[model samples]
Target: MKKIIVVAGLLLTMGFHASAEGYQVNLQSTKQAGMAHVGAALKLGAESMHFNPAGLSFMKENISLSAGASAVFTDLEYSKDGYKHNSDNPIGTPFYLYAGFKIYDNLAAGVSVNTPYGSSIDWGVNWAGSRLVQDITLKSFSIQPTISYRPFEKLSLGAGLMFMYGNFSLSRVLIPAGDLESLRPFAAAVPSLGQTLDNFKDIDAASATLSGDAGVKVGFNIGAMYDITDKITVGVSYRSKVKMRVPEGHAEMNYANETELKQMIATVNPLLIAYKKNPIVIPPLDKGTFSAELPLPSNLNVAVSYQATDRLLLSGEVQFVGWSAYKALNVQFSQEVLNGYSINAPKNYENTRIYRLGGQFAATERLDLRLGAYLDESPVPGEFLNPETPSMNKMGLSTGLSFRPLERLSVDLAFTYVTGFGRDGSYPYVSNDQVKAFGGHYDVKALNPSFGISYAF
Candidate 1:
């Protein structure tokens, strides 16, 4: 029975990495995203509150407000063992809002609301790999209140308080026929396992699902921006890691179908009877609660902005993600029979560096055009890659335009296309304490379009 508990989580992790940034989302600003997120040292209206709070000190107005939304279309394909399969096309919607004010001659304050991490994956209930994952969804959002101070001209410093909330859910199937290791230890008592081991085939015991909600988590960030020359500006920022946990949530477990299950039981019962051993008794799958915890990676960003001409601005940026701090995922369940039932998987994710370049051209006093590109690195090594996310090093192209139709109002629009190189990987199915292997390959692509409007008063 204990071994059965271990086999229950075979594919529980299949849905862990749907969002980019290794489950982190980077589309907080459509304008910045359109510029491949290269505006660390550039003035970006009120939206700058989220990217670099210190930028607020450069605002041209006493009060500013901005809002935007993004739509993402994604496709993921897999091929293995001469079989080609793909997950359902997943669509993600992310949005953000920002407000800033010049509180004093040298001080600025602002607030931001945004979806920082989120995405959903569906593998269809009857797909070849359905046994591993049916559906998985992750949603996360954050609120930040920031303040910036310019103690001296040309230099600004800022800080913010972060509050976050998230939700997670994962579903998969359980195999009844225990793998060799799971049954081997109990083989002495259940003589039938040894007698009919070769005759038994792995079949569904039940459909299992776990869902949890994150309690409020807190973290902080700080930034510095300085003007080196009349046309050059540099900025650096850091966001600390957030530790989050789902206190206690619900789990659903039950037989999805009964015809085949009854037949399998009938086949094994007589064998146990003849061996004078207790007949195999499948227990009812009970619904209960569970707990889980995960850590949000820390981030460091740096960039330099250059005014190449009177109407042209260029910027280059670098960002480092501390994914190595993510070591494992732990889940604990509540139930007498599953009293200590838990699942823990090692991630061993690595830190990654991202490069971005962008330029903005002022076509007219009220019209601006932006162009940018970026190369993003995946933190998961090939050997550790899993179906949960088909993440790979990616190259992205983006463009956007900002128009001021009214004296105090500006509207922004942006678009981006991102794709990954093919990646192949295999996952080990664990039974008892031993592992068996399976192989597969994955290819993924995404298209995102965004809209925004801002007002300066």
Candidate 2:
């Protein structure tokens, strides 16, 4: 049963990728809680290592450590013509860890392990759209070690080396049997219908293959922060994109009968069967590479904080993400095995900009509370929204609290609500220019809540 489930999961992953909107995963960390408080580290503690490594320059402690986790919920639905289907993904948990220290009077260094990208979708096998894409699983994790220097009392510079690892699995079903009859007329037109039939049979037996891959990559980030005054600050950073390659992978096909397929080939023109075997068996076996050139989108952040009677702080920021550079998923394979299977993603995707505003209040000498909101634009077009990575414009609302039971120990907890623009699209089963079947639009949605703890030594 487990093997069957695994195979089914693999098949679902393939179908989803065939229709995915972007090759990138959407696993942004909850570290944004600290980002909400512009002075979180410049005047507070170590969470700055993630919000802006440059903020580490303001750390006064010899050592600081922080860890946290979040529970995410996603709901999706689809509609087309007069039919509709929906899927609600179970709550998922993602985590993060960060450690930093003041190395010298003007310098600081830190390290972090966080899940920057990942998501999973599982639609029931009986759903009408399941044949198109039943499930999708993708994970992107990174370890970044950084250094920061305060050149002046009001300015800081930072840089980090990043090591990233990722994995992807997608699946769907391809009905080659249903397509054979549609090609009968074309096959009959060829003179040798028997030979043509043999070729078609081989293709059908090999048409659908379960595919998956895994890989590793590395990159870097550089940033700067400037304190314009006691109440305002700004930051700029660039993350270099990294490329990952899947060295070896596996592919499988759902065959009704291995014995019958062999017998049919022996009785028919075996040469034609052998010639067509390459397209079916060997083609899916090729070691294809999945390279993700995830350039760290350049970001510009300007933040302002005002002190209301030295107890409450209000802050807001505007950010821009250089997403336009993320234009395609360039796939490459060995020429000997995959002569015609390489594909380049379509080029309609564009970069996105985000706006964020929030405030924090120090209700007590030892307690801090925060609230924030942000609007994020969608990078995907309507035509590309699919079961895998179904992306849309997103809006978020968040609330968090920090407690200081001791002078050196602090605990922070946060909750966030993320919603996406509902979308519609279609998937068609086509091989050799003929459509055998089709599935209509579907919908999805998500929510996330998180918590963290920090200690200073």
Candidate 3:
């Protein structure tokens, strides 16, 4: 049928842009009251373009906007001793939008649209680890354009440019038997009639698919504030590290009953080519085109702040993430019968450090209150836990509230919580007589919630 509709439109254009390893879902946005205070204001405003665009040079005088949403919950488990499985995923819905503006007098600008990363898992295909993975969904979105500058009075600088979008889906199944392919024998082998066969061969595919490519990222932020008198005031900021690239697409491989396995490999390729003329490793029904490559790693932030009165405020922060440049997964096949099948996916991912503390209280003149805490560390390790991406080590909690009622109008709310402490890995399967099956060990847990709102003109 037109070659199965042009191979299903090239597997939907190879799903668009591939670059997924697993465990990513931060959602970005909801620091209402700056998570209690620690955000310290990288210059403060336009949501500081996601935490620091020199805080948009402390934008003032008309122009500001914000919106938010978040919800994520996950709990996955796999066991042995008679086999048992569990999965619960649903609570994902991240939404956001931001805007800020100010021109001349020191310049300032902003823009944002978020959903940092995403995830979803579904398991149970008859258990027994179902080959290791049953279902997985991923998403990433970002849009940032910012600028800030303040020549004097205490320094301030900012810049940004980010545009990203991603999506993915997965599924699996493969089986082979028949006495392991009749113990490979065509003539020599007669030890009283060697025997062992059960007859079996089934290879199903499609766990996830979708890809699109794009790249060009950059970030910078620097801030300083000092007034060690008149009641003391000090602040510092530095944020940089953003490099992303995702290019390559087009993939389609749908073969199951593909015309009765292409007429049983054209009747067993001329009877195995006259009983072994060497030119038949079980071939037939071969189609092509496949590609994938993704790398977007970099992060660093440091902060410290103190107001201590006039409504109270205090903050602290430190964050760094490099993720060992994500190990491997370079697969490019256009027929060579699957040349050099690469899929290492091991970088032992590390380079992680996160700590934050906050507090803010106004309680009058219009009301305001906030509180925060965080500690996250886990660059996936535990034998490279896999199920697409199952990471661990996390703890966070935050609360916020703000209101002005009028005077340009203002209202904001925030909430956050994350927890995950479970680990174990190993999942690799490849069979078609090319034998290779190893799938066992798994456990995971996660949760998140956030909200936001702001307006001034």
Candidate 4:
């Protein structure tokens, strides 16, 4: 039972990578998505709160509002030992809303609501890797209240308070049908137990479901921006790490041969004691609860943008993710129910960086064209990769356009394609005091389409 809780924590964290490289989502703004999410140095009116809040003070209008959403479709394939399986991932819709007000000549205030992390992936229950993970889903949202100030003509600073909420559920096979033969020795010692085991020896009979809610957590986002010249700007932003904690979670067990399993356990207990081995304890699922904690690593972004010509603008940025903070995962179960068993699993994730470049051209009086690309490094090591999150280095290409039919209203559309480099990896874990490993080749790809509308006056 303790092992189940430990594995559940891993699945919950790993499951977050369905939409991005790690537990992150960058679909905060349609305009920025078209530019590979690079807007740290650009003054994007109300939509700048997520990228760099300092840009808000540079808005030219008294009021600005933007709302957008993206549909993410992902495909993942796995192959090992001539066996193949594919992930049935549902379409993920990440959306954002922002409203900014110019309070004074040098002051701006705004609020943003968005889905920064979430995922859903399902591999059939009978798959080869069912013992590791069968299905998982995670959902999260954050609300930020931000303020920006221009202390000087060329320098602006900003800050925001982030309130975040998240929840997850996952299922996995507890025991595989192929491993039942290992218990034949004990079964042989008890005649009735042997008959019960032989009756359904090849059936995948046991599984578990773990679900939890991460209560509200608080964090902050801060940023600074400076005008290097009339046509050049530079900016830096930092988003603090938020620790998501599940105080009490639910776990349930299912057995295909419940009556037979109970009978076998009762029959085998005396034989095991005769051999001086510990007896199996039935899991107390009806009243048991679990607790866990996972950090939503911090990130820093530095960017520069140049207005080269009257109709052309170019921007670039480098993002440093502090994934090293996630050194391990810990889960604790209630002592009253399970003897207070706890497990601390080491992850040893390393920090990574992302590179982005984008450009926008004012094609006509009412149209703007944009193109961008980015390269994201995988944070998970090859040896620790698992089926739940087959993370690999990836490249993304994007294109978009904005159309203005009315003077104060603009419509936006953007599309992005992401492809991961094929890789083979393995995940090793301990089961019943024995080390076991699961390995395979994985390939992944995703397509994203976004639409939005912004109005400023």
Best by lDDT: 4
For model 1, residues 1-457, the per-residue Cα lDDT tens digits are 3233225564245335543658777788867876887867987657777778888888879999999998888778878878987778568888999999998878999999998778777765545555567678888888999999999899998899989999987776554433323344445766655544444344444566667799999988788899999999999888889978989877676564455545545665565466554554443334466677888888899999999999999999998989888788777766766554567877788999989998889999898899999888998877667666667888888999989999788888998888887788876665434575556888888888999898999
lDDT of 4 by residue, 144-219 (tens): 9999999999999999999999998877766655444545676545666566767646665567778899999999
**Which candidate tops TM-score?**
4
The list of candidate 1 runs beyond 4 A from truth reads 1-6, 10-15, 176-205, 258-286, 431-434
Tens-place lDDT digits, model 2, residues 232-324 = 666665666565555554455454455554454344334334444212222343244322233334444455555555766666665555556
**TM-score of every model versus the real structure:** 0.88, 0.76, 0.33, 0.91
Q: Candidate 1, which ten residues in sequence have the lowest lDDT sum?
A: 176-185
* lDDT of model 4, residue 145: 98
Q: State in Å the error of residue 278, model 4.
A: 5.4
Cα lDDT listed for each candidate: 0.76, 0.57, 0.53, 0.83
Runs in model 3 deviating more than 4 A are: 1-24, 27-47, 51-54, 59-75, 78-82, 85-106, 109-115, 118-143, 148-162, 165-171, 174-249, 252-417, 420-457
Residue pairs with backbone atoms closer than 3 Å in model 1 (clashes): none
User: Each candidate: how many clashes?
Assistant: 0, 25, 19, 0
